[model samples]
Target chain A: MRFLHTADWHLGRLFHARSLIEDQAYILDQFVELVRTERPDAVLIAGDVYDRAVPPPEAVALLDDVLARIILDVGVPVVLIAGNHDSAQRLEFGARLMQSQGLHVAGCTSATPACVSLHDAHGEVRLYALPYAEPAVVRDALGAELPTHEAALCAQLDAIRASHPAGVRSVVVGHAFVVGGAVSESERPLSVGGSGAVAAQAFQGFDLVALGHLHRPQTLDGRVHYAGSLLKYSLSECGHDKSVSMIELGADGSVQITPMPLRPLRDLRIVEGALAELIAAAADDARRDDYVYARLTDTGALLDPMAKLRQAYPNALAVERTVLARGGVAGDAARRLREQSTGELFASFFREVADAELDDGQRGALEQVLAGMAAAQRESA
Target chain B: MRFLHTADWHLGRLFHARSLIEDQAYILDQFVELVRTERPDAVLIAGDVYDRAVPPPEAVALLDDVLARIILDVGVPVVLIAGNHDSAQRLEFGARLMQSQGLHVAGCTSATPACVSLHDAHGEVRLYALPYAEPAVVRDALGAELPTHEAALCAQLDAIRASHPAGVRSVVVGHAFVVGGAVSESERPLSVGGSGAVAAQAFQGFDLVALGHLHRPQTLDGRVHYAGSLLKYSLSECGHDKSVSMIELGADGSVQITPMPLRPLRDLRIVEGALAELIAAAADDARRDDYVYARLTDTGALLDPMAKLRQAYPNALAVERTVLARGGVAGDAARRLREQSTGELFASFFREVADAELDDGQRGALEQVLAGMAAAQRESA
Candidate 1:
């Protein structure tokens, strides 16, 4: 049985305050085409289907459209689990009813991992789905004393092992921060201050394991795989070679895994140079339409850097003065705060208050308030 | 064919500054029991399944649980639409696949209204579901010039009539603001500054019209009925007799409508009297545990009115001195703003910024800030 494995769509993600829904929509359209061309028997989305617990309306619509195409147009069975970023109940809303349509979603952790069995010419293959769950959730569900993520996951693996006897070809799907996997800024910490890693050996018994929560595609011991996110979700993930994993489980228990690259509509690129050189490079580059994050290395101030860059690269998202001249008051932190724009000041203050960076809407509101104050002062003058 | 008709659930509503999720859960549990006992052929939730377009996670879970019980446990078919408060695409997520399981959700305005047919002992009963949509949406869907709510609804009704031929015992379920119905503060205006009301006669052809978007259960002409909300969503709805409409549609196109009252876990009560008299009344009242909105008619200065009321009514949500002494600078609005408690100041400021009242979380944060400021001032002294 052949299946496509992918995860961490993060459909409503924002990169540098710009909405990525349209970009995601474009990429998913291509994914549907790929699925249609490959004609895989099933698709496995390990987890992190949405960027937030409550996704924006457009993201929900995009998911709806893509899933419809995959299930109806391509006629492929799709299995998915909820991730730490998802609201389990929301993702699992109509899961039971959807099973008939070949769409299976497991959102909450259970004592026994939810299993779906498929029959081929040789025999039967069982697929176990384990959604992201806290150690406390596992303890409560099983009435056990599992203290860490590894313990919780090991407990679940043991249950799966018990449910299915030996010699049954099985695959396990999970969303976890497996120990030794590379981390990225886009992926949220599974637990407080980064301590929610699970041992790779906990999932050793399964023929293959498809994992999520890390935005890089890599294999551990050649059996456990992280399918990774489809697009670059953050500037830090610009270096990630995002792709989907295609796996074929032979009737004889032999397995084959391959990575099929997905070309994004707009590549996420970070360029560093002097302002003038950056503009010249952008003009010469064919990917000027790509989402650009430019870090200017100029020692002196540049006039309207973002505006100037946008003339050459229309999709420039952010422009930062990375290098500063060694000076007296310019180096002072208090002076830096005062010299920043109203948007920057408000963004910094909001980060301190909310413990999260501000979205574009918040920045827009701050800009309006500052504009109004400036107008009032000008009128008084 | 008999069915329970309900609407305006506002499942994640906030009353004053408290979440109504628990109250909604309790009421929905009873509703599930009612469905089990009544054994209706089907259930119609007209609209407003959520209080906001993007609901909190708990509300999503509650709706999922209640719907699961009604559809899976009680084994009843459910037909629902999206109201103004809901994001149509979000609610319509798995609608097509859910149809096989007897769960029908119509959340977008299409060229034609979505119709579902059920077989009863008599014969075939047709039910049309029209989800809430703005005038622009209807215009875009049908490619017509429907500039008003009435025009858009009339167009949909015309389409339904055209498709169903004639002489069929049909029921139309919709979420709309029908003209001549009493308005309540809890019910959000369908359009800006009012003007979203469709004429009652626009729905004249249907044998029965189950409507939502109004918090009061009323009939425009006996054929069109507003099932009303499940509970009192606002202080203005304290006087409303909230209930669900139970309808029996005969094969002969005859209709019998009955209002079945729902008992809430905590009833909403509005109390008005002098501060001392109100407390005395609360002491005598049996429903002191109910959510109380007190309008104190005191003419003199009252210290800590909310705190004093809370002593008598533990669930006192709000306390307001409607009539203050008409003298001195104390009567000035600016002076009153300065003299109010930190909570009050924060609430007013939040209302101005968000265009809505602050919830309990915001109020608690304000109290903490005030306490910290007071402590710092004392330390400085």
Candidate 2:
């Protein structure tokens, strides 16, 4: 069955405090055109559909528009999941209602391993939405010791496989930082907190794995791949070969993946030169530019660098005149308070932060809390 | 000409700090069903689409589901605007993109009104999305100095007529406080800083003015009306008749607005009775038994009023005992400081609030500001 695979749209992102809503729309517009052209049997968005857990209203509008086009306009079933960046509660809010519109949204880690089987010419192709899972969530869901990311993912995948036996032609969609895949510079460092891991071989059983979270669209062992974000949201993703992965899974469990091209709103070019030269270079570079970020190598101070850059690039995301001077402070008091107790820490930090005073009662309460912590540590030891 | 009038949805609203998202959906479910049954030419969500400018993700998802149903599933043209409680920049974020899907969203209070003419069997019906306009916005738009709401609205209406020459079937969907519309208890006091006077005559020329801001579905002088909020977001709106207005414009300059009853999530009730009596009375009043609030008037604080009430009303918005009193020391102090200079008032208020001292430099700066204010008052005198 022909199906398009893409994920991590991350709409409503603000790169360097400049809103990327218009830029994001530019990319989404291209995506809609692709859906209209390709006419895939079903579209799979792995995860992290929004840049933030709580996206602005504009973000909502964008996602709504795109989903409508794909599901309603094109009359294709679209299966989606909530990624680490997404608020599961929000993405899954109207799942019961959206299901009637040929759109399947899986936000709950529990309704996971959710398989959507669509009838093609040959037979049924099951699509599983395994959202980014936490170890704790897995442990709670299965009552097993899924201590690491790999274990949690393995547990969930096992559950997903149980739903469909080995004969079922299935594709697993996920948002995880898997091992063996080169971490993209733009991808936020994969969290190893309460419920995350990046163990490779988690999706060993699936015919194809559609991934997100990592902005770089690439294949791991030529099977799993990160579709990446729709647009470049940060300078860290400076050289990201940003694109969506278009994967086609056959009824016989055969797979074909293609790199879909991206259309950027503006060239996010970084130039290094002297302050004046950098500004001039940016001015020369600002040919139908949508957004720009520049760094200067001037040793001396260039007064009002941003204002100067704005004279050339109206929407310069950043203009920092590099200070090549030696970094040496006479006495950095901050280094001393690092090991202080909650009360001493507060008093010392506040002494610098605001010269704000804390009365004895408040200080005493903090001291008691520290004492309690020490006692608990000792007891545990 | 035909159009469905709906307003005061108040997504992400809190009825005394309790979320009303579910109620919003419950009410909107019926709204969509009505739209399908009615099959109106277009739908107009006047304003207050969301309760807060930064709505919670739940509200966003709820709105997405509802809008998707209206614009995509039902395949009806939808016109929307940002209300007083919403941030225009946020609401209009992806409006330009949504226009492709036959959704016209106007979120700006600019010089010219956003008039989209619909070609129907009745020749043409011009739908103007004139959102909630404050005096400053109205004055800026019309190039006129204004105080009364009526004068400001008159100026804008005159401009619309001058441009569009309101046909017999021109409709204006607005979010504003008209003079005579009955304000529900839950509806926020519309005129806060200024006494707005949106006289009935200002709505002349337009066959139907779909109004919002006042969350009570009613006709003002048999012409203007408020399409009340979907579900009760505040206790004041309890027992208020909430519904969406359906308008049908004839070939002549006459119109008929039908108040389509929106099935509220649950009948909001505020009962004052003995704690024992209310709980004993809960078995019968449970019919779409969800989201409730109560005030108990027992002689003294009964043991765990919440627990007892929960037995009958599991989803109680709030259960407050009239016997439990709140301290009013701050209120009394605020009353006394009403006549003080701004600086003095702030300083004194902060001193009491923080219970802290101001250094010499801070105090002197504050005193100098207060003295400057005193001098200004003297000069004006």
Candidate 3:
């Protein structure tokens, strides 16, 4: 059984406050062509079908068009699972009815098997889909006391394994942050602290595990793979080689994995140089049409550097100045600013101003004053 | 042939910055029950399916559930058209596929016959749907220079008429502001001044013309009718008797119209009285759960009137004070203040302050100073 694994379409995403609907549409058209040519028996989208819980109308229309073309026009079955960015109920609205037409979408996580059985030269291969859920949701759904991502996922997977028929090849699809997987800036934090990560060993029973959530493609082992996001959503993701996973499951529970590249309409690139040299280079660069994030190394400020750069590269999103940070002093200061708490920063400022360390009583008084001010502000607001 | 005609659903509407999704869902569920009990030959939804071009996820989900229940579960045919609030292409997505499932949605006005033919015990009844379109859209679709709503609609109706076979009764559905139809504050203007009002005579030929866009239920003639909206959308529409239209089209082109009241989840009401009396009456009133707009006739300034009212009427949306206007002095002044332009007000103020009217040069200098201050503030901001 052959299937294509992809996720994080992020339809209706806004990049630098500009709508990326047209760009998404263009790339998805290419995705349709890819599906047609590949002729996968089923396509698995792990999660994040929409950028927000409530997508724009054009995004909804685009999804409707793509799904219809793939399911009705190409006659291919699709299995999808909702991610954190999707409203599960909204995505699952017509899932049961859509099943008859070979569009299987799982918008909620449960202990019960939400699997689609497909046949090829192999007798049968069951693909179990688990949509993204918070630890609390998973615990409630399973009627278990699992409190962490690993425990919740393990409980759900154990139930799935118990229900699995013996000697049938199986695949597991999930939207989770797996341990040892790399992440990009655009990927939202899955949990409040460091508790969202799950272990690869928990998913060991499945022949192949298609994962999502991390925006950079990664692999825990030969059997577990991250499909990653198709588009470069942030400048920090400029280095990511976005791709989808192609899985071929054999009759004897053996699997083969291949990476399929989804070329973006306009590549995202970061360029650094003196403003003049950067502009000169951009004029002759083949990738000038790409979305550019330029970092200028000029010590003195350049007047309207962005406008000047746009003359050669019209898609320059932003220009960064390295004037104060060339020797790393400003960079260190920024790092310290991010790492320190407000109370500690204030204490340091007080010491600098007074040229003496604050006594315990003074520090306590200062903290009380700050707390009172905060309380008053909250009350008035 | 019997059919239930409804329009101006305004799903995803916001009232006083609060989402109306829950209210809309409650009403639409009742609508589903109405469809089941009535068992009309077909249901005709005239237009304004959504409040905005892009609705939230819950609104989309609600519509999906309602349509599926009516078309798939209850096994009824529904014919709908796009309103000014909808994006035609978005609403039209998957329309052809939905047609096979007894759901007909027309998203754009066209010269082509956009009709769904349904058969009853007597004969075939053609429902010609013309979605809302601007003059430009209509002209482009028809390849004509028609410049007014009446002409554009006449052309569309002519196309439908030319496609109509003899000896068969037909109904026309449209989303336009007809002349002489009552309107409410919430209904958006369909076009620039004057041109939006289409003459009622233009729709004379159809056995029944279902109209939308006017929030007040009205009839230009016995044949042309506005179903109005399902709920009281604006405070100005407090007196509107909101209802859906039930039309029975005879085989010989005779039609009977009936108004069907849709029970709202919560009624909208306006209460005007002295503060003490209104509060006293609220204790005995059973409709305190209604959304209330209160006008208190207290002569002196009242303290926290809205907060006090909420003790009895928690859903009170607005409060107006009649303190200063009790004897009509403040009311007249407020009316004049609203009616006068800035220049006129400035002139009057100058006359009062200087004991004389200003000449053109002085007025020009004042205007320039105000303009300069505005420019400086904008620049600083």
DockQ, every prediction: 0.45, 0.15, 0.30
**lDDT (Cα) of model 3:** 0.81
| Model 1 docking category | acceptable
> Cα miss at B317, model 3 (Å)?
4.3
Best by lDDT: 1
On the 0 to 100 scale, the lDDT of residue A328 in model 3 is: 78
TM-score of 3: 0.80
Clashing pairs in 1: none
Off-target runs (Cα >4 Å) in candidate 1 are: A251-254, A271-285, A295-302, A319-381, B271-288, B294-312, B320-381
Question: What local distance difference test score does each model get?
Answer: 0.84, 0.72, 0.81
Measured over all alpha carbons after superposition, the RMSD of each candidate to the real structure, in angstroms, is: 11.3, 10.9, 7.2
Worst 10 residues of 1 chain A by lDDT: A372-381
lDDT (tens digit, per residue) of candidate 3 on B1-381: 888989999888999887878778888888899899999988888888888765666776788789889988998988889988776766775565566677788985666958788887778888888999877688999999987778888888888778689878788888998888887888876653234788888886688888889988888788888889978889988999988878888878787888988888778899998778888899999889788999888777788988889888878888887665445777788878965646678889999999999887887787656555533432222
The full ranking of all candidates by lDDT, starting with the best, is 1, 3, 2
Better of 2 and 3 by DockQ: 3
Worst 10 residues of 3 chain A by lDDT: A372-381
Error of 3 at B27 (Å): 2.9
